[model samples]
Target: MNAGIPAAARELTDRLGPDAVATSGPLYDRTRRVWNGAVTNRPALVVHARGTADVQAAVRAARDHGLPLSVRGGGHDWLGRGVRDGALVIDLAGMRRVEVDAQAAVATVDGGATAADLIGAASPHGLSAVTGTVGAVGVAGLTLGGGYGLLNGRFGLALDNLLAADVVLADGRAVTADADHEAELFWAIRGGGGNFGVVTSMRHRLHRADPILAGTIFYPLPQAAAVLDRLNEVLSAAPDELTVAIAMLTGPGGAPGLGLLPAWSGDPAPGEAHIDRLRRLGSPAFAKVGPTTYSDLLHANDEQGETIGHHVACRTRSVPHLTPDTVSALVKAAATFTSPLSRVLCGQFHGAAARVPVESTAFGLRRNHIMATIISWWPPGDAEPHQTWADAVSEALARDALPGGYPNGLSPDDTTQIADAYGPNATRLRAAKTRYDPSNTFTATPLP
Candidate 1:
């Protein structure tokens, strides 16, 4: 234990026992390593909450002690917000319990469930919800941040499918927030992020999507510009049943390439035309677009997990259409990537995402055809070029945008980007923060 441990943390351990409260030792390092040894975090203590009651105790203790509480679910936060230096981390990784009611078409998921757990549970019933690309990302943070994924264009954001949530307020009482219950808090949680409170459980709208037709298609690097141009054209006229994301990366041997991850919710045959058109643009290096289980596709990107070592910065923005200029910018940027692990990604934002009026949810950037993310990866070391590279890429890409942040895509560290993400809704989020957490006790992001 640390020398200055708070009395509240001690009290929590007294009530829940030692296993519930992680004081010092291996688990603490494990929590720190979640940020990949890059960001520095020395929390006074870490509370591993196993249930709603445990979460309640931790919250009350933190509030009573005036200690900042960081809610950690899957521990995949891009900004490393899950564990802060000298704060109490309410680790929710142990609370992963997924209850799927196929008849009701809803899934009651604990705050700790990862995308992998949710997909695995729902896929058997031929049901799924919109989540992030990474299978290990916390469902709570990802959904509240406007989740984007293969199903995004088809089903809109993960929050768009949110039916209800059980959030522990600043006052230490657990309340269910939904359309008809705690309606205002429900709206705030939809896209406002974790600024208001800690969400312990959620009710998500699930769709019947099993054995989905999904996989990635790789093309020669020379055809990336052409591929993006056509992608914009096809997605503009495409239906909500089809969603796709384009990735530009320097391959294993430094061979630059482009990958298209296409997912079709309906019949897989209809997507044949689009896939074929893409195939004709350039010779394929590898292509696996066909009928597959959702679990298989969910695990496809697991290989990248090993590459996350330290500080990683990502910049995102939306463009009306993939113009020649944008395509050329992406092509040129691919050359500057020093890390083979780095990538420039293009995710489609159409279908149900656009059909919803922009004002319907707190998530912004609705009227664009593409969402571009530039990521820089490296081990912990000097912060010079790492910071420069991330800034340059994000700056060059963040030009076009709609108001309000996309929630799922923006990192907590990007305050300016948060403004871009929230746009008009930014003001309301601040006001909600004031009313709900007037003392700023629950502050995390979407800063007031």
Candidate 2:
């Protein structure tokens, strides 16, 4: 035993057993690792929580010891807010349990459960939850920070589908928040990020969606500008069941390309026409569009090598429309990418997601818009050039973008963007924060 270990950590181990707490060694190393390789923070103590009680114990221990605290679910945050240097981290990776009620069309997912976990659990029931495109993203983190995904066109955001949540507060009190109970907390958590408490479990409403028409169509990089313009035109009158994501990335053959990933949740007959419009937009170098399961679509990005262990920097801009100027900027940025691993992705927010009232939840933007995610990645030990490229692209897009970016994609240090993320709901969100966590013991995404 290391004599230098803190007394609080020792006490936690005594309460939860030796297997639950790790001060050093391989377990600590594994628990502390996040998706962004750039973040190298080392927590002094990591508690592998197996249940809500374990999370409560960890939270109380951190409070008693005056240690900074963080919670790790899927640990896919680009900014790596789940593990902080010298903090005591509650590792929820061991608690991923998902339960589905076919009759009710609802799923109760443990906080650590990823999108993949929930989707796999619900697929057998012919249902699907509104989840982000990536399978590995944590359900709790994504919902709290405003989840934007393929189903948003028809079902709204993941946060909007959240029916209730079980949270462990800063004071060590466990409570269930829903529309009727802890109403303010419920509203805040909808889009407020994890600034109030550690969610132990979440109940999400599911939709009947088994087979979805979806796939990607890639064109040569030279046609990016024209493709983007056509994309905007198509989406202008798109149906609620249609959602598309555009990406400018280097393909497998070391060639740059513009790819359009479309998901149609409506009947297969009508979906073919919508897909045909996209194919006609440009001469596709590679196209694959057909009937597929939603689970398969969610796993597409993970299969394409979006795994951990790479230095990455991300920037975001919310463009109300993809005008000529915006398209030009995006094409220029993609053409000048510093690293081959770097890419730009644009997710369209419309239909059901845009119909929600802005003040109904803490999420700032409810209008139809394009969330431009500028991502730059490189091999370990080389970050400067990639980060610079991402920043320059963000700067170029600022003039044509909305006042604030997506809260989920914005970094904690982005003060200006953070201030504007909540828009008119900023004051109300702060009030809720004070009421639930006056001491500010939990701070994941920086609140406005």
Candidate 3:
């Protein structure tokens, strides 16, 4: 055991054996890093949990020793909540196992499973799970927060598809939460995030995996305002099967442009008409709409995200409608990007996702709106300018934006944003947090 670690952490290493615990050295270094390169928090001990029992033990150890506790699923959180300074991390990286029940249309996914893992398993069975645009993100984390994706129009958000979850609570007790059992905890976990406990596994409802028309269409930067205006009009009456996400990004030859990514989950016959309508929005520099597999579509997004550099700063806003002012603000922000890697992404929330009653789950803002993500990134140097640019863009759009932001994208220190995001559900969520985790041992996304 490494003498540098706390005695409580060292005791945990002794019980789990050397392979399962990393007090220091190369293993600890490798497991400490998250998706965001800017985060450099180091845990006192990294417990590589392989199953539910291992997680239970880690929670017990952290509670008994009075050490801060954090859980690492896919370790893709932009905020890097998985690894905290001087905390004991229950690293679930080794627990990625996915089992699909084709007949029941449910997949049992381990806590560590990524969107790719679940997609790969379900696609083989001619099924698909609602996941975020990026495949590398953790399924548990995404579902615990509100998961937004192309399929959300046909299905609902990822949390809406969550059928059940196996959670290790603050007291180290294992329990299964679903609609029929521990209903309140079930509601809280749907959108309350990982505040209640460490989720070891989850059961997600899967939909039929059918090839649909999906791809991107890019337009010149000069025509962004017009394109956005037309896009807002088109989305107002868009069918439930079609979902489109708009991005102001640097395109080929490092030229700033507007890109629209559209996915249709229903029959391709009618989807062709919808694609054609979007194609005529503006004079496109490039378009690649066609019938493609969901897995391939997700892989394409993963490849695109990989190019945005390691260090990143992101801000988000929920706009009820893409008014002319909102469009102008986004275009202006894109024009003055601090780095070529900076971009503004907006995803529409509607159809099935919007139809769910607000009180049905803990997720706030159920009405149709656009979730704008302002992101800036650089190489490995200072990130002050990039962060400033993102924050400024967020402020500019605040006039036309909603009160709250996306919980998954918000930072822990954003107290006001957190309160706004939870809205009326804040009271019940706080009660659930107090009931299930009074000591606040697990802190994933900041609670309202």
lDDT of each: 0.76, 0.89, 0.89
TM-score of 3: 0.97
TM-score order, best first, reads 2, 3, 1
Stretches > 4 Å off in candidate 2: 1-5
Which digits, one per residue and each the tens of the lDDT, describe model 1 over residues 1-448?
A: 4333558767988999988787679887677566444666777789888899998998888878878788877777666678877778898888999999999989999999999999888888888878877787789888887777888777888889999999988878899988888888888887788878888999999987766777778876787777777777677777788887888887655688888878888766776776666566566788877887767777877655545566676667666777776777777677677666678887888888778776666765567467787777776666678667767766666554443344555665667666667656667777777777787766555452
Give lDDT tens digits, candidate 2, residues 1-448. 2333387688898999999999889999998888888889988789999998999998888888788888888888888889988888999999899999999999999999999999999999999999988899899999999998888999999999999999999999999999999999999999999999999999999998769999889988899888888888898888899999888888777888888989999998999999999999989998999999989888887888575788888999999888888888888887888878888988889999999999989999999998999999887976788888898889888989998788878887789998999989999999999999998988888787
Over 4 Å off, model 3: 1-5, 307-309
Q: Which lDDT tens digits does candidate 3 get at residues 61-139?
A: 8888778889988777777889988888988889899999999999999999999999999998889999988888889
Clashing residue pairs in candidate 1 are: 42-86, 145-407, 145-408, 146-408, 404-421, 404-422, 404-423, 405-421, 405-422
By lDDT, the best candidate is 2
My TM-score estimates for the predictions, one after another, are 0.94, 0.98, 0.97
* Model 1: residue 314 alpha-carbon error in angstroms: 2.0
TM-score of the candidate numbered 1?
0.94
Q: Please list the Cα RMSD from the true structure of every candidate, rounded to 1 decimal place.
A: 2.2, 1.6, 1.7
> What local lDDT score does residue 267 receive in model 1, on the 0 to 100 scale?
69
